[model samples]
Target chain A: MNKKCTTDPDRSYKQPEFDLDKYIPGHSVDCVIVGYENQQLKILLVKWKLGGPWALPGGFVGRDQDLEAAAHQVLEERTGLKSIFLQQFHTFGRSDRHSRFKEQMDQVKAISQQLGTMDLKFSKWASQRFISTGYFALTEIKKTCPKPDFLSEKCEWVSLEKLPELIFDHNKIVDKTLKHLRIQLNFLPIGISLMPHKFTMQDLQKLYEAILQRPLERSNFQRKILKLGMLHRNGKLLTGAANKAPYLYSFNLEKYNSMVENGIGFSYLGDKIL
Target chain B: MNKKCTTDPDRSYKQPEFDLDKYIPGHSVDCVIVGYENQQLKILLVKWKLGGPWALPGGFVGRDQDLEAAAHQVLEERTGLKSIFLQQFHTFGRSDRHSRFKEQMDQVKAISQQLGTMDLKFSKWASQRFISTGYFALTEIKKTCPKPDFLSEKCEWVSLEKLPELIFDHNKIVDKTLKHLRIQLNFLPIGISLMPHKFTMQDLQKLYEAILQRPLERSNFQRKILKLGMLHRNGKLLTGAANKAPYLYSFNLEKYNSMVENGIGFSYLGDKIL
Candidate 1:
């Protein structure tokens, strides 16, 4: 059932030899690194070399490594983004999570065997049920350098609205992350993490609109956000229509940090939108 | 080094024999079932028969069981409360989580050996590194009937203020759960789950005070809660002083459920308190 493809004589993307004894079995970590660019919300996804479906960038936990540290390592390896604040949103542990991907797994095994990298122990270990912890982070799009892992051939940003069918339960993980982000909008540093250093009021509003997926009333949104006292009003952008040029603003770091530390009530879109 | 106690020849509290092959190793579920009583917040804790420190009710997951189902089973086994909503707040996965309790675990082994239930497989499995998921639930105090597990001799409600040093990282888990509860106060069904069918406004305020650990302004609290329109007034609470009696209120289930589904801005206590 393996799909035939041109083999790389140098084996640049060959699977890394794992010391199965050095890692704990039946537990793994998956990360959803989200970024905003061109007014669209995006997540990092990886595609396996053997013509399989896309999946989140994930790896197993080391036998002695802290769980948070393991998540950090995975984030760095996949995105070249280090020390980003990744939050553990949930743990998914359905016994049949892997059973749905049986055909794809069989194809992976066949491809690995053809490449002469397959071992009985690794095959058995890969087939066991896993209880995976999901962690997510918001990042600035320009700051990341995405790279695929050893087993995958491509890593790219896919818009949330057009996400392809992901392997296993990764799509559910992304949905849960979005729900958590919406609920925690007031507490999260969305502007600082996802937007440019200094942006026009419209730029900030569009970012919120993208996340909330609804158009907020302009005047109301501005009044409530300014009331929080975390934004510094900069000079207006000199557009062709000078009077209509909306003022630029940037986050006042100290006040923003304080408000984020103790959550603010910035839910101006109200209960219906949230 | 085992603490000696009068052992029942019938071995009523004997350790249950586990089929190691039927369960997943290196993972467990710990529950923090918090209940409101006497104007204080309390959590269920269990004391081991061999004189170890108190711990949350916990057990291993079956190889074929869903993670949440395992958590529910643990909750039902310890509290005799069935089918209550249990939320998984965080997963604690430090490699050395059990290292701090080496002496206690050794004592457990010695006691189990004396009781003739110490199998080598079980001992080895128990000593390995475990990554435990922490689940929390809010319930009415009168509804629960606490009972200890096979390894524990006492299961009782312990006030949060007077909690003893718990085994492993359970104290940290409780702190995380409280922070989550505070952040989610507006979205949770606190009144429905923790209050009586008919309660004075004073009782509802007391529950929030216990959770926030500070007193809120009475007029402001009443106004904000009333604005939400999720409580039904059921006449005055008849106390000795009729003129000073506060109004009784019960949750408007339809409205309460709607507000919970779509979150409201109920952080009237201000950002400083949160």
Candidate 2:
């Protein structure tokens, strides 16, 4: 993954000696980088340059680093977004998760032919079965300037509704991340981090609805959210809507945090919605 | 850990050479087996025979087994409980988590001396830093007869309030598991698994209070739980007191599952509880 020192490499790669002690072998970190933009929920993904399908922007944990720190580094490298809300929701350790790589051996061969060389050590090590820890990040899509790492073609925001074929268990990771987000939404007002500085009740509602994947009763959502004392009725938004101008509110940080700590409870959708 | 074949092994253990391909290196599974009895929350712990302090009843994941399967295997081996509600909550990946191994080297040495001959391979491999996935299981205490694994002393449920000195990050794992449980309570009618097959509203309320670690208004708690529609009120349980008997409720599986599927939301305790 790329941070500020974004570089592109399309040449023969030299393999390094295998040092099992230097890396937390058989484990990797995958970021389900969820973003909000244009009233749609999206995930930041990377197109591997070598021999793989598109996958979540992921990186190996440094031998010396804490997993959380590694996750932050990966997020920063992949999305150029840091200090956002990130949570380790699940760790996937299925034995057959790497079967996709075997199926994509053709792609591996094609990439090898195109690049004219493959890093032998990397090829051997990367093909091994790996258990991945999944961390989901919520950031405003506009703030992120995603750049691909040396091994990836490009990094871009893909709408969750229209995700391309992903490598390994990445598609499953994205699905789990969404489920975690929805469950978290039941107890926490989760979208303020992705919201603008000031927004109408409708804007907040839209963000929640997007994560929830369903429409919520507008006034009910507003009342429930307001009762948690998370929003400050700052002023009214001057909008193009013909109806009465909806009030603009900024998050009361203190109240929002306490509410998050105490869990603001609300239920949405049902089997009917399903 | 043993399922039913609980044989006491207070002896040194010879560790086998860890084959990298046969197992996912540097990763392990730890089960925070939480059980309830007499209105107290407890965790199943084991004492290592050759080294280490008291720790969670956990085992290694087979090379071919899924992480969840490994957790269940560990749980069943330790607690003799199978097909229970087990959730993988988090993974602990701090580099310094194994500081305890180095710090407790004296204890390891003492155990080695006591065991007459330390299995060099096992000792060296056991003390190495490991990232562990934490899975929490809730089952009725009466049904479980926890047995220690071959590598440790007897297994027993220790009250959450009076935890013994634990090896590595096991204590932190337990605390995190409880936090997960408490958070889960806001969204689901948990502790039902920890309760008797049939329980009064007061029994359920007490269980919640124990988990919540505070008092809740009785009527409010009853009203809230009843509203979830998961409880099927059976005949009332007559008591010696003159007050009206509390209704005994059985979990309506379909309704309870649906309520669990769509989170059951209610928040008790104030800002301080957080």
Candidate 3:
């Protein structure tokens, strides 16, 4: 069978030096699954499987898996989150993200050895160069029960503005994902999974403001969002701040899904009738 | 100083290995710059520098250059087309787009050797594994004076629908770029660069329809597109074929650019505006 594989007419031996280290040299996927809860946008991250560094939850692709599927699998494993809104935003292939991290691996391994559970082979494997694709997602924070994987110590939600120093170039990856999410928000129903079942206009706007990192003009933001036509207006929220109660809203799931399928191009700067 | 450089205070080595076949494998960027002319979306391609196979206009990156700049340089080299909107849509990193063209390389090399002017060393180098990043652009077909680089025999614009079987997985890359372009069309002023300076409503609609590869309702398409408020009505085109003269329009570049900068959302489908 091996001889037949080597002489197969359809598939020839191209790069015979198929060392896992060589061919699998520099490519990976890192996920930044951002969720909204209590009117805030939070990102799911994991502390290092081995060390103290925190990072956007990530995993390397298995030999037989599609790169994208590997990202979703990583999301499920690290965050206990499944079938959420996931998307690939960017691929970070800078030489520095890999090489700089490799430079620190020996020091990290030395630190681990002193802690008394070090496996040198795994440490070496961890030190190899990698180019990672970035996938972002929006989910309900309360729905996910985050757990650190074999390679990590903790999994937690980190506010985008208050993110800690991350391992490798994960901070940059998170930043890129956040930017992509904000741009997508301008055209997509972003809070469907991120927000709770019922939210006031202010709650949704706060989530948007947090993701955008900019405070929007209130009346305009509310009017524009309501005009999208996917939100189902519900009973008023009895809030202490206002005598006139704020109306609660939920995504009309069927309409929202169909809008996503067809796409919603809502340019705020465009026609007023829309 | 040289000896001290070998063992710096920071580390034992400042430079990592730069092996062409190993560390810094042969990487190239192929530009699938698409242009619309005569109501068709077309791609710019080049014949191989060595021989028969036609592929997207592509070139290698210098060790010191940014990956993005390398793509733009390749575009400029092949088309003398400078600074029309370009984006890196995807990077082809599977170990296959490399070896996928190996069989064709062998046949082409054999023919060239028979011709007695082929350099075996160059031929071998040309066939080496390459991981390429794909960038695409929208530009005026008339403005571009396409020409092949030192490695190609021909350069020209080919209709996207009528493209020949391109060398390697270039056809796949082109397909990927087009899909990305379609998604990003609402955000970009595609009509500005891809269409002639002045065009009838049918011409503009046909261009969008061609890129989208779908039929659009005439009145609805016209209304949604014009509602964006970045088109200027010119006189009228006397279409010798039909009823009345369709109104000729020109894209308002300044307004179109501002819309792109300040997000344009298309929320035409379902109840919500995107």
Candidate 3 chain A weakest lDDT stretch, 10 residues? A1-10
Clash-forming residue pairs, model 1: none
Clashing residue pairs in candidate 2 are B1-B149
What is the fnat of model 3 with respect to the true interface contacts?
A: 0.05
Instruction: Please compute DockQ, using alpha carbons, for every candidate against the native two-chain complex.
Output: 0.52, 0.44, 0.11
> What's the DockQ of model 1?
0.52
Alpha-carbon local distance difference test for all models: 0.79, 0.75, 0.69
Evaluate residue B163 in candidate 1 and report its C-alpha lDDT on the 0 to 100 scale: 95
Backbone clashes per model, in order? 0, 1, 19
Candidate 2 vs 3: which has more DockQ: 2
Model 3 residue A61 lDDT?
A: 61
User: TM-scores of the models, in the given order?
Assistant: 0.87, 0.83, 0.65
For lDDT, candidate 2 versus 3, the one ahead is 2
Second chain TM-score, each model: 0.88, 0.85, 0.80
- Docking quality tier of candidate 3? incorrect
**RMSD in angstroms, candidate 3?**
12.3
Candidate 3: list runs displaced more than 4 Å.
Answer: A1-23, A49-52, A98-128, A200-202, A215-227, A233-249, A269-274, B1-30, B36-40, B46-66, B80-85, B91-132, B138-155, B165-176, B179-274
Model 1 RMSD in Å is 5.7
Residues A1-274 of candidate 1: C-alpha lDDT, one tens digit per residue: 1133233223233356656776899999999998888899999999977786799988889999988888888888776767776889899988888867778668656644443344766766766799999999888767777777776788888899999999878889989988877866756656777877888888888888888888888998888778888889988888887477778899899997887777666664354545
Which ten-residue region of model 2 chain B has the weakest summed lDDT?
Answer: B6-15
B125-161 in candidate 2: lDDT tens per residue? 5555678999999988787777666567668888889
